[model samples]
Target chain A: MKLSIENLNSFYGSVQVLRELTLHVNTGEVLCLLGRNGAGKTTILKSIMGLVEHNGSIMLGDCEISGLGAHEIPRKGIGYVPQGRRLFAELTVKENLQIGMLIKGEDSHSLDRIFKLFPVLKERLKQESGTLSGGEQQMLAMARALCLQPGVLLLDEPTEGLMPSMIASIRDVVLKLREQGVGILLVEQRIDAVLPVANRVAFIENGYVKAEMERDELANEPDLMRHYVGI
Target chain B: MDFGPFLFLATLEGLVQAAVLCLIALGLSLVFGVMRVVNVAHGEFYMLGAVLAWWITGWFAGNPAIGFVAAIIIGPLLVGVIAYFVERLILRKVEYDPEATIVATIGILYIVQQLVLITFGPDARPVDTPFYFLIEFPWFGYSGYKLLVICAAIMLLLAVWYVITRTRLGLVMRATQYDRETAQNFGIAVNQVYAIVFATGAGLAAVAAVLIVPIQQAHYLMGRDPLLLSFIVVIIGGLGSIRGTLVAALIIGLSDGIISVFFSPTLAKMVSTLLVAMVLVFKPEGLFGSRSQL
Candidate 1:
């Protein structure tokens, strides 16, 4: 994790969001962001990744990447799994990954590593990205991001609308990412799926962090869950 | 010997005109392919090419062969250099703004035209044909210079085809056009490609002008007809398809030639327009334009 966002305030065309929000994650930590719809949970991850316009300070160690462009952010070792999986529809899976590697400026080791982590992607490497099933497409998107060899990984709604089994698989992947000492910020509507894996939790409400807790403190606090997250 | 035979000879004359027309269109197609900008001043570049050729060739007033050789070699490269500056300074920034880009090009066109008129005068100048001899075939006879232009044009076209298909530069151009951002992410420098493509296109137009200078009188205003013909060729040929442009050029050349022989010039024009309409209705993408391109 080794990541921190302090007193972060964001806006979309004068509309305020994430009012003075603050959250932190340590190394090898899976921090889940829990909220209902319009919770600005995805916005948090997007803002951190510099995908959206925002006024916030996002720090990965000594490096502060706020108000940077998406392309510039990735090179700073931050990977984003944007909502809707935004895969290049026309490009083949391999081509999509190659484009990532290309953007990251050619590392043969990263390419070989991603292919190894997602073996199914390596098998169907030449297939068009749009043809992949939901689970496979998710794997491809994650793999594309992983090719950047990011120190900080931002997963936006990774398990949204997936079958239970698929959700469990993604959950397992997130846990494995945590084990590998990757700083992960997970945005998910499926609270139960992420609760078991997250080291700490942040509840976002009305564009700010309403509550923050360690896994033990969060699991014990029933009133906070029902009041802030609607249980 | 026979007055009636003038009709047959005029037909071959028209093919010469078509050859020059194809060159103009081919250049237009090239510029449009990489830059995605329709250069209104393109005809002016062709005219400049012809004028420069005329000037350069006139340098060796007595030595016609040397002059002819000089026009082909020096005319294009010189215009290409001028075009390189115009692209870098003028058209480069306004590329995405097509309408504004056209106005800017037209501005350059007027400046160049007036400059030529001021320097060369309003009178149309007769450019000397390197070889004044006539070459007669079984069916018709033509000025040796006109035949040479036809031959040279075909060679230029072939060279252009080879460059576009066989070169590494061409691959990057095609890839960039399809998806610019994606291409850039793949380590392709798009700006360099755009400039080079623009220069190549302008160079091609200059070559066409050099070849045709001898057959027609070279004047400041001589570029309009070539401009019109180039537009027609691009329309009939699919946009950005080099093969389609060449095929369309030959078809237009042959048809215009045959028509001028058998009918009046007005009727030939009417036939060409009608054919374009038919093609538009039946195959709107020209000959080879893809669905996405259209």
Candidate 2:
């Protein structure tokens, strides 16, 4: 399946955040959105997830999901790991995962699969999610999203404020998801961290996609990377 | 009467008051906890339940047992339906804004009270107990119905606790309470959850009224005391803490019952209100509420 956002414009109140941002991600691929703060990178993801009010078309394969509600978007095969790892702080890790399955109308069979993906979650299943470290919280967030078994995953700054070791583990997890044929739209500030895992990269600036390139082209054009993304 | 018999009676009376207070305050806490909306109309729902109970029992004037049974089942359901519509039509329009909902529910309280006054009349009415078997103590004989009310309240509270802790519906509510936006991102229909929570809260209050209406006569004005007391319970316990609400209700109920039995009911209320003021002044997060994460 392919996730496509075309001519998307987003606004908070009257203030515009994203302007005609166009991007797409195919299954078995990682598309990294790199931009500075206030460049509307997160807004693009929020727009796709229907978290923010936006104009223009967002298509998950053949389904036009632009105007769908936030809750409806996830049921349409779009999983979201929002910024700050917004886990239900008071809920046990297992209960949190159960909520994901409950929403998807799926059974708890996928729970073992999620546990296998993030083994730490298994050990902490009964512990309140708020007690987990920052990295563990991110893992729980991702695992919660994966419980939906979505074809497309939208991750907003999953690696922010994480230690280097945690960042590496998250990168490995992203690559592993790619291998499983899940499309990932990752928004990140660290180009070096995501460049290794991303199949394609889109540089967003001033609420627009300024440049798009394949990993090979990015590897070959060092100066282009610096000019577009300031990496 | 000797002090031993008097103390025993006071203790039993306190237990009964705690039982009723727990049910009413639990409902108030659940609504405030999940939706962060102070439902000022909650007491009105309680009043509606008692009023409905009287009307339904009056239908079967000869058979008090059947009437009480039917009213117990019907009263809460009717109040729940009303609450569901209020949430959808009025609260939803205001986006469940905290201040806005307070005003909206206050309006609803007055509207409900006046409507009941018009339809059910301004006179107080009573419903007969389903069963009448007095338990004779060595010192004094007590009404079996009041004891039944205590047991019934405990069972209802336990059922509520079980549903909240052991069911998927409970998990959804807790998740929504933790973070509504995140719950929505996970494909949970937050608005639907809010509606259900609102109705359930109102329904619990209605159930409390159904249980107590046999002892206390139902009137348009009776809602005021329970509403004030439930607020005191919720405030003293913590805005959203269920465990706290229960404990606080027990303390408030028992103290009110004993003090009212010894001194005056008004004195009990004054002391409780003073306690609330002290809690607010000293520990604003409440006795059981954690320090605000903010």
Candidate 3:
């Protein structure tokens, strides 16, 4: 299944954030959205998930999901790991995962898969999610999303503020999910992190898609990174 | 009267007061916790419960028990239905904005109060106790119905606790309470949850009122004390904290009851108001609430 957005225009109040932006992530591919701050990378993902006011179309497989309620959008097999890992802080880790399972009407089998992916969650299952370390919290957030068994996963800044080891683990999870045929739409600050997992990169500027390149094209054109991302 | 028996009487009165207040405050806390909106009309719902109980019980002229049982079952249901419509029509229109909801609920409060006043009249009508039994204490006899109220409140609280902690519906509610947007991300219909929660909150208040109407009277203005006391309890317990509401209710209710019997009702209110000020200044998170922003 493919996730596609065409001529998307999103606004916050009267101020427009995404102006005629278009992007797509193919099945079994990791498409990284690269941009400077305020370039509307996060807004695109939010618009896809119906979390923002947007014009134009978001199609998941054959279904048009542009105007669906935010809650309804997720049940359409599009899992979203929002920025800042908005885990239910007071709920226990087990309860957090239970919510994910309950969302998709999945049984404990999905939980077993998640446990295989991140064993640390099982150990701290009884602990409150708020008390988890940053890495653990991030993992729990991803695990919660993955419980949906979504075909298209929207991950915003998954490895932000994480230790190098934790970042590597997150990168591996992304790669694993990609291998499982989940279309991953990722936004990350680390170019090095993107290089390993991203099959294609789209440069966004001023709420528009400025350029697009394959992974090899990005590896060769190092100056493109400095120009678009200011790194 | 001996001091021991006097004290015992005060304690019993306090327990009954606390039982009723706990149910009322828990509803307020639940509304605040789930929706983050202050429901000023909560007290009116309580008043409606009492009035409805009186109205429903009037049908069973021969047996007060049948009438009382019918009142208990029908009163809260009617209140819940009314509340559900109120939420869907009014609160949802405002998008649950904090300030707008306050004003809206205030409107609802007056509308409900006036409707009752117009129809039920302004009389302080009394509902008969379902059963006329007394528990024989060593010193004196106590009303068994009052003790039954305490037990009913406990059972209801436990049922609420189980639903919140052990059921999927409770998980969804807690998840929505924790983070609204994320709950949306995981396919939880937050708006629908809000409507259900608002109704449930009102229903809880109604249940409390129905339970207490026999002890007190079904007066349109009776919501005033319970509302103020519930506010004080909610604030002292911590906004949106169930355990906090329970603990605060006990503290305030017992103190008010004991003080009222010994001193004056005015002193009890004053003491509780002063305690609210102290709690706000010293521990705004409440005695049982986590140190999080209210």
Best candidate (score: TM-score): 3
lDDT of 1 by residue, B159-223 (tens): 87777655555555665665554354334566777778777778888888888877677789988
The segments of candidate 1 whose C-alpha lies over 4 angstroms from its true place after superposition are: A1-231, B1-20, B58-70, B125-137, B140-168, B181-192, B279-284, B291-294
Name the weakest run of 10 consecutive residues (lDDT summed) in model 2 chain A.
A102-111
Q: Give the whole-model CA lDDT for all candidates, comma-separated.
A: 0.77, 0.89, 0.92
DockQ, Cα level, model 1: 0.16
The DockQ-based order of candidates, best leading, equals 3, 2, 1
Q: What tens-digit string does per-residue lDDT give for candidate 2 at B71-110?
A: 9999999999999999999999999999999999999999
lDDT of residue B194 for candidate 1: 75
Worst 10-residue stretch by lDDT in candidate 3 chain A? A101-110
Model 1 chain B weakest 10-residue run by lDDT: B179-188
* Better candidate by TM-score, 1 or 3: 3
Instruction: Looking at model 2 chain B, report the run of 10 residues with the lowest lDDT sum.
Output: B285-294
Better of 2 and 3 by lDDT: 3
- Output the lDDT of residue A195, model 3: 68
The per-candidate TM-score of the B chain, in the order shown, comes to 0.91, 0.97, 0.98
Fnat: each model in turn? 0.12, 0.79, 0.88
